[model samples]
Target chain A: MIKVEWFYWLCGAIFIAVAALTFADGTNAKRYGSGAFWGLLGGAFIYSTFVVHKTAPASVLGLAVIMMALLVATGQLGRGDTTGPSRAEQEAGADRFGNRLFVPALTIPVVVIIFAVGLAKIHVGSEPLLEKSSETLIGLGVASIVAVIIGFVMLRPKSPLAPLSEGRRLLEAIGWAAVLPQMLATLGQLFVAAGVGKQVGRLTEHVLPSGSLFGGVLVYCVGMALFTIIMGNAFGAFPIMTAAIGYPVLVQHFHGNAAAVFAIGMLAGFCGTLCTPMAANFNIVPAALLEMKDKYGPIKAQIPTAIPLLACNVALMYFLAF
Target chain B: MLVLLGVLLVVIGFALRLNPLVVVTVAGIVTGFLGHLSVIAILNAFGNGFATSRSVTLFVLVLPVIGLIERFGLQEQGRRLIARLHALTTGRLLVLYLLIRQISSALGLASINGPAALVRPLIYPMAEGAAERRFGRAIPEAMREKVKGYSASADTVGQFFGEDIFVAIGSILLITGFVDTTYHLKLDALNVALWAIPTAICAYAIHGTRLFLLDRRLDRMAEAAGLTTRPDKADAQEAGR
Candidate 1:
C-alpha cells in the first residue's frame, strides 16, 4: 500500500544519493559516470511520475529538469577545459568543400517536403489539396521547387556538401533500419483499425478476475511492456495490444478512467524498450553509432536499471491507475 | 497479401543491398498496389508518413551540421579540451553525454542526433585524448574502440528512457489510443507518461554506473594482457638515447 507520495520521496532520495556519490568521487571520472547513471534513472522515475500528473506542456518542462540534472552530473555542461582542435585532426576533417553540414541540413527539408505533399494528397484531412488536377499539379510543383532549391544550395558542386559523396554509403549502411519506424507505425494503425484489438479484448475477458480493479491494472501495464519488447517500437505494439486488450476490456468493461489507464499503459511499454533490441532506435542505433565490439553494449548497460523501473511502473499503475 | 508482398520486397531489397530509398519506394508501391491503391495513392502514403512525423526528419538536417563541426576539428577540439582537464575521465564525459541525450529526448526533441552524429568524428577522439593524457600516453586501439562503444551506449539508454515521459510524443499518444480502445478502458496519455519516470531513472543510474566502471575494466584488461606501460617506457628510453 505504498502511496504515490512515498514513491516521489524515494525518487528524490535516489537523486540525492546520486549527487552525493558524484560529489564524493567527482574528481574520479569513472565514479562520477557511475553516479550520474544511477542518479538519472532515479530522477527520471520520480520526475516522470510528477509529469504524468501535470499537463502535456508541463511534462516537457519536467523532462528538461531531468536533462539539466543529468548534464550537471555528467560534467558536459559544467566547467571544464574547452580547447580547439589540433592542426592534423582539422586537416583530416576538412575537405575541398567548405564543410560537411550539407547532409543533415539537406535531409530535414527533403523529409519535410515529401511529407507535406503526401499528407495533402491522402485525403486524410477534410480538405484534399488534390481535389482538382490543377491543385494536385500545383502541390507537386511546390514540393519540387523546394526540393530543387534545397538540393542546389546544399549539393552545389563546390559547396561544402560536396564532401557528402559518402552519403550514399551511409544511407546504405542504415538501410532497412531507416524505414522500420514507418512500417511499424503503419502496422500498429492497421492492427487497431481492423478489429484485431477487439479480438484481443474478447480473449482477455474470460481469463482475468471479473472485477478485481488492481488485477486489471497489473495486466494492462505488464502486457504493454511485454508487447513493446516484441515489437521494438512501443508505438507499433500499442494499437494492437491496447485496442484489443486495454480499451474494450479494461476501460469499458471495468469502468476505468480512459486517460489514466492509457497513459500509464504506454509508460509500461517504454519499460520494455530498455531491455529489447527490437526497438532499433534504442538497441541497434547505439551499437551502430558506437561501433561497439559487442552489439549488446547498450542492452547490457540497460538491464539492471530497466528491470527495477519495470517493477516500479507496474506498482504505480496498480496503485495510481486503479 | 499486399502487406506480405510489401514485406517480401523489403526483405529482398535489403538482402540485395539495393539503394534503401529505392527499395522502400518499391516496397511501398507494391503494398499500395496489392491494397488496390492507385499510383498516386501509394505516393501520397509515403508523403503522409513523412509529413506527420516531420520531427523524425530533423536529424537529416543535424547530420550535415555535425559533419561540418567535425570537419573543423570538433573531435580534436574535444580531445584537447579533455586532456587539459586533469580531473576529467572518459566515464564522466560519457555520463554527461547520456544525461543531455536523455533529457532532450524526453522533451520530444528525440532528435538529439549530435552524439551519434558526432561520436565517430569527435567524441571518440576526444575520449582517446583524455585517456592518453591521464595514462601518460596514447591508449591502445582496442581500448579506444571500447570508449567509443560505451559513449554510444550511454546515448541510447538516456533517450530510450527519457522520451516516454512526454505525453505528446508519438509513442505516448500511440500507447494511449491503443490501450483505451483495446481494453475498453479509459486511460490517459499523462498516466502512461507519468509512470515512465521511474523507468527512466533506472536507465540513467544503471547505465551511468557502467560508464563509471568502464575505465577500470579497460585498465584491468590491458594489465592482464601484459602489454602495459613497458612498451611506452621502452619507446621513451630509445627516444632519449
Candidate 2:
C-alpha cells in the first residue's frame, strides 16, 4: 500500500529545490535568510521521514523549527526579485491559449476528486491502494504533480525550471505568513501538553451559574467561539469547551441533544475562525495571496458575517438542540 | 493555571503587533516551562507537532501549478469569460460561487476551490471583471479591495458551513467521536450532520444577503465616485432586462 510519506518526500524535494533556486538568484537582497528558511523547512520534511523510523531524534527537528522561527521573528526572510511572465506575454498567452489556460488549473481538483472520492477504496488482493489515513492529503500531492505535468505540456515554457522559479516568486510573496498555520497548529499541541485546556475548562466551570439551561447553553456556545478565536481552530477548542460546559451542564443537566449541541457548537467555533488572524490560513493567508494593502482585510470582511452567524448559532442551539 | 500565560502572551503579542513567529515561540516555551517540562522535552513537543502538521502546508505543492497558469494568463482568461457573460454583476457572481462552493463542499468536494487554487486565479478576476463592466472604468482601489474581501469570504463561509453537513467530514466525525467516547452517549454521526442543516441554511441566507448587499454597495460607490450620472436608471433598466 502506498503511504503519505512518499508524497511528503516529494514535497520536501520541491522545497529544497526552490531554496536552491533562491540561493542562486543574485537579485534577492536577503538571499541567505530566504534560502536558509526554505532550506530548513525542506530539511524538516526530509528529516521527518527518518524521525518516524526512530533513527533521528525529534528534538533535533524541534531545534530546527526554533531556528526557523527565529529566522522569521528576526525579519531575516525577504522576497526575491523573481518575476513571472510579463503582462504583455500573459495577455498574448491568454489570447493564444484562451480557456485552455483553465484546463491545467482545473485538473488539480478533478484529479483530487478522482483519487479522494472515486479511488479511495481501490485494492489489490485486499491491500488498499491508498493510505486510508491520509487519502485526501495524498490525493492533493498526486493532483499537484499531475497538474504541474499538464502545465508543462500546455504552457510549454522555454526553461524546464520555470515552474519552480514561478512557484518561488509566489511563495516569497506570501513569506512568513505561509508557515503561520503550521506554527499555530504546533502551538495548539503545546497548549494541550501543558494542560492549558484543563485549566481553561476549570475556569469556565467555576464561572458558570448553576442549573440555568439558557446560561449553560449560552456559555457553551460562546466559550467554543471564544476559545477557537484564541486557538485559531475549532478542533483545538472543541474538547475543552465540550468538557467544560457542553457535556456536564448542557447535555447532562439541561438534557440538550448531544448531536445538535455539539454539531452547532463546533459551527459556533467556526464563527470565531472567521474573526481571528490566528487562523492564518483562512484569514491572513488569503490577504497575502490577494496582495491586499491591509493584512487584516479578510478578517475585517468576515467579522460582519461572523458576528451575525455566531448569534445565529446561539439561537439555533437554543431552539433546536433540545 | 500559570500555564495559561501562553494564551495571555498570544493576546498581548498580537495586540502589540510583535512578530507572531517570535510571540508564538516564546509563548510555547514559557507555557511548557510553567508546565514543568524540560527544555529538551519542549523541543520534542514542538518538533513532533510541526512534523505531524506538515499537511497544512501541502498547499505549497500546488503553488507551482498556480504560478504557471497565472504566468500564462489564467486570470486574464477568467476575466474574459466573465466579461462575455455581460449580466454577471459582482454581487451576483459571488452569490453564484458561494452557492456552488457551499453545495459542492456539502457533497464532500471541499478541495475543489481555495484561495490559491481558484480565488486568486479565477474568482477574484471574474468578480473584478464584472465590476469593471458595471462601472465602465477601473474600479477605485478601495472598491477593488472590498471585492477581494468578499470573493475570499464567499469561499470561506461556503466551506465552513457546508463541510459540516457531510457526515464523513472531519468535524462530524470529531463531534461523534468526542461525545461517544467521553460520555458513552452512542451518538450517531448522521444526527450530528443532520443538525448542521439548519445552520447551513441560515449561513447561506445570512451570507447570501450580505453578498446581495455588496452589489448595492458597489453601485453606491460608483455613484459617489461620479462614475455614473444616472445610476438608478441604469440599474433599473438592467434589472428590467
Model 1 agreement with the true structure over A1-322: per-residue lDDT tens digits: 1122342344345344544544465444444544454354345444444444443233343233334334433443221121333567465544333333333333433443344345435553565534322222222223333433454454343454332322222222332343344334333333343334445565566766777776667677777777667645455445545555566666667765565566657666777776787666557676776667777766765666666666766676566555
lDDT of 1 at A72: 38
Report the C-alpha lDDT of model 1 over B86-205, residue by residue, as the tens digit.
Answer: 335677777776776677666444543545555555556666655665454655666766776676666666766777774434565444333332233333444456667766776677
Residues B1-241, candidate 2, lDDT per residue (tens digit)? 8988887887677556677777878888998899998999999888876776666566678778888888888756655653554357789888878887787677554644578767897789888877876787667898999999998999899999998875545566566545543455666555577799998898899899999899899888988887853354574477468
Count the clashes in each prediction: 63, 0
Error of 2 at B13 (Å): 1.2
Docking model 1 quality class: incorrect
Error of 1 at A177 (Å): 9.9
The whole-model lDDT of each prediction reads 0.51, 0.79
Off by over 4 Å in 2: A208-221, A224-304, A314-322, B88-201, B210-241
- Candidate 2 local lDDT, A68-131, one digit each (tens): 9999878888877777667698789999999888787667666766776767779978888988
